[model samples]
Target: MINNNSVTFIMAGRRQRRRRWLLVTGLLTALACILCCFMLLLGNTIYPVNEVLRALSGEQINGVSFAINTIRLPRMLTGLIAGFAFGIAGNTFQTMLRNPLASPDVIGITAGSSAAAVFCILILHTSGAIVSIASVIAGLITVLLIYIFSRGCTFSIGRLILIGIGIQAMLNALISYLLLVGAQQDIPAALRWLSGSLNGSQMDELPPLAITVLLFAPIVILLGKHLSMLELGEQSAISLGVNTDMTRITLIVSAVCMIALATATTGPIAFVAFLSGPIAKRLVGAGFSNALPAGLVGINLVLGADLIGQFAFDVRYPVGIITGILGAPYLIFLLIRMNRKGDL
Candidate 1:
């Protein structure tokens, strides 16, 4: 039944897909680099690339040094790292669950982290490491609860998503209640963080997020093939000799840690996690893993949205506002399409 012509055609198609994946991924990486450069060079005062480089190299270049080192660098790093976390995490959940709506942001994982952070800010009057720690812990706890409740004799993606959305609603209500009773002075800080501004990002705050991503990203990437197999459903993954349970747990844990740290840092930048995976999947096509591409796409969206927010309007909007504006219409479109397909 095997034919040389069919085999040859299949091989050619495989090669073409691989080439496309490489091309798209390379371009995304280049664009992200360009955005990073712009983040450094184009601030209140525009500095030339050479001056930015010199400043980065520890040269005392007057105002450029402080602006680049103290302000822009940290902001850029925060967006870059956080966006990567969101993208990869979002993609992992969507792929594993076979549903776009399963994103941590959509499901209430971010809300759980946000709720914890807000509680720390309002009730406990805490900041720094305490808030971040609480966020990570809360995110883990939230996902654990979702997992426990959604499991039965058989696992159901539908049940998990429903539970997640319900939890999100409850957590959001808690956030609102906290805001209502909290001190007026603390409200402004909490609101700014909730809106996900990169403003006031400091170098020291970058380490926990940066280290978490660095540690976990490789694990995700290494297991990317197994993750893709998981997209075929549990039985199919098992038939393919993949340890579905271990793979799922590894991915969920890794993704949750990264996203939680990111939420702690950026206060749940809207929809970056939700949008990155599908976009990356479309770009990279079917054969290759979309994890890295998703991360790159996330970097572009966050940095691009931040830039638009900063300069596109008379009043600078927070990054979350820009991303929210971008994501809302897509969400509506997705719902309509899913409904048309009887998937809702």
Candidate 2:
């Protein structure tokens, strides 16, 4: 049982896995950094990377200072933070549920936040702090409702997803109703938020999200091992001494907190949450923690799409529209594949 050859083989396998993880993470980090710089330097009046760096370092350089420090900086930061949050939260759900399709975006978590935020904009006539608070509260409530409805004699990811879809449909209708009754002046703002743009994101609006991401991300990463364990199914995870219920609740709350804030900050940003996880998984492979890598993918997706939406297209679409285009086909393909296998 303790053969020297077997021990050596196991050691070699572990080393190989470690190397793959390192390579994937390093590539993702580099890609994210390049995109971040690109976001800063490319715009209507393209600034040199040096000028951009100067502005970031608190230098005052006229157009470069205003563009880099004020306008583009907030937008870029929002994308990075929100993308990371979305990626981590989405990947968490997918991992816990063992279903590629089981993401907050696909389910109804973001919709909850969206509905609340839209309501606040239209009904409450709220802005800033109140709106963000409402979004977080709404998102938590929506997930709670989904969980309650989906709870049955046995735990079922499929059932939860189905219920979430139904809830999403209802919430979409509510959002449409608000749009119909909303004032003409508010409609544009509401639509823009719904479509998810970072055009005029204020610097002041970022601190809450930054703090949230910093706070909960470590918790999620710490729980990554437990998350991986949960993949073994509830009974098996419990057998392995995981407090299944407690772990899920804590993870869900932390994730919803990040997702809601990000949605409030950037209007859900379409499939950043849904697409980032699967994409990162493909690149990073299995048998290792993919949470951080997934977050990196999210940052890249958001920044890249925002860049493309801003510069690549003449029409100047919102980030959400571009992400929607990217995500919709994959969703359809997934559905088709699932149907063929009778999983739908």
RMSD of each: 1.2, 1.2
Q: Which stretches of candidate 1 lie over 4 Å from their true place?
A: none
> What local lDDT does model 1 show for residue 247?
90
Which tens-of-lDDT digit does each residue in 258-303 have in candidate 1?
Answer: 9998999999899999999999999999998999999999999999
- What's each prediction's TM-score? 0.97, 0.97
Q: For candidate 2, which ten residues in a row score worst on lDDT?
A: 280-289
Error of 2 at 180 (Å): 1.1
- Counted clashes in each candidate structure: 0, 0
Candidate 2, 180-210: lDDT as tens digits: 9998899999999999898898799999899
Candidate 2 is scored at a TM of 0.97
